[model samples]
Target: MTTMNLPIISSCSVDGCSYNHDHDCHAGAITVTDAAGAACGTYVDASDKGGVDASGRVGACHRSDCTHNDHLECTASGVEVGAGADRADCLTFAPA
Candidate 1:
């Protein structure tokens, strides 16, 4: 099988986000989309107590308007997750 070159989630500072592990994102990958701001569509509230054990990676993105997205994949080497208008957001997102 061919492997995909998904971007890694470098860091996340949203303490209440389920995918965050010691300031790092633990989801396999994340999708970024436009909400009130550049939001992390993969972000789940830790109150729900759900998350993956592996390090986070950027799988698919819906922000087709973002400059860093190509074919729904993030081209950035890495991404940062942090608080936004809603909750967790992709800090590397840039509008195209």
Candidate 2:
């Protein structure tokens, strides 16, 4: 997994959700889902601004051994985005 020194927001937008710990996204695998869970939030339109919404709509895997993961954040440079079967939800998720 690559390493990202980027600083993400201190809290998640999900209401009543408690996955963040001291501004560190420790959700293991953050899940990004629409209100209806119909599609992954990471699926960006090619025409979207900035290429994608790296902060608001992407998912990440915090698993210690995942090659594509890095401390709960995506280290693919500007591709802080990820896709998932459940609305781009974090596949390596863990309850707070």
Candidate 3:
């Protein structure tokens, strides 16, 4: 199997997200996007609920303007997800 060293989702406050459980993220990986604002591209509706036991990691980041973005990858020590204007957002996102 291929190994990937990606940033972790340290915390999440969007209890309505499918990947959020007990204020933590359990998805295998997540994608950060900025289509409308810095947000979690992997977020799903509150009705959906499914994720792994372990915490989620950043698989890809499309917010090129984010300071932690490097070639579409997140370079932050860890990321936080929570409710935002886009529904779910990357709290760690900051402009470069």
Pairs with steric clashes in candidate 2: 29-90, 29-92, 30-90, 31-89, 31-90, 32-89
**Per-candidate alpha-carbon RMSD to the true structure:** 2.2, 12.4, 2.0
lDDT string for model 3 (1-96, tens) is 122579999999986888888888988999998776688988887677799989999999999998999988899989988877677899899889
Which prediction has the highest TM-score against the true structure? 3
Local accuracy of candidate 2 as per-residue lDDT tens digits, 1-96: 322354343334222233322322333333333323223233332322332223332244344343444565544332222234432334433333
The candidates, ranked best first by TM-score, are 3, 1, 2
Q: Residue 94 CA error for candidate 1 (Å)?
A: 1.0
Task: Provide the lDDT at 18 for model 3.
Answer: 86
> lDDT ranking from best to worst?
3, 1, 2
Global Cα lDDT for candidate 1: 0.79
Tens digit of lDDT per residue, candidate 1, span 13-50?
88888777788787776778767677888888756645
Q: What global local distance difference test value does model 2 have? A: 0.34
Clashes of each: 2, 6, 0
lDDT, candidate 3, equals: 0.86
| Candidate 1 worst ten-residue window by lDDT | 1-10
Model 2 — which ten-residue stretch has the worst lDDT? 44-53
Model 1 ranges off by over 4 Å: 1-4, 48-50
TM-score of 3: 0.89
Off by over 4 Å in 3: 1-4
Cα-based lDDT for every prediction: 0.79, 0.34, 0.86
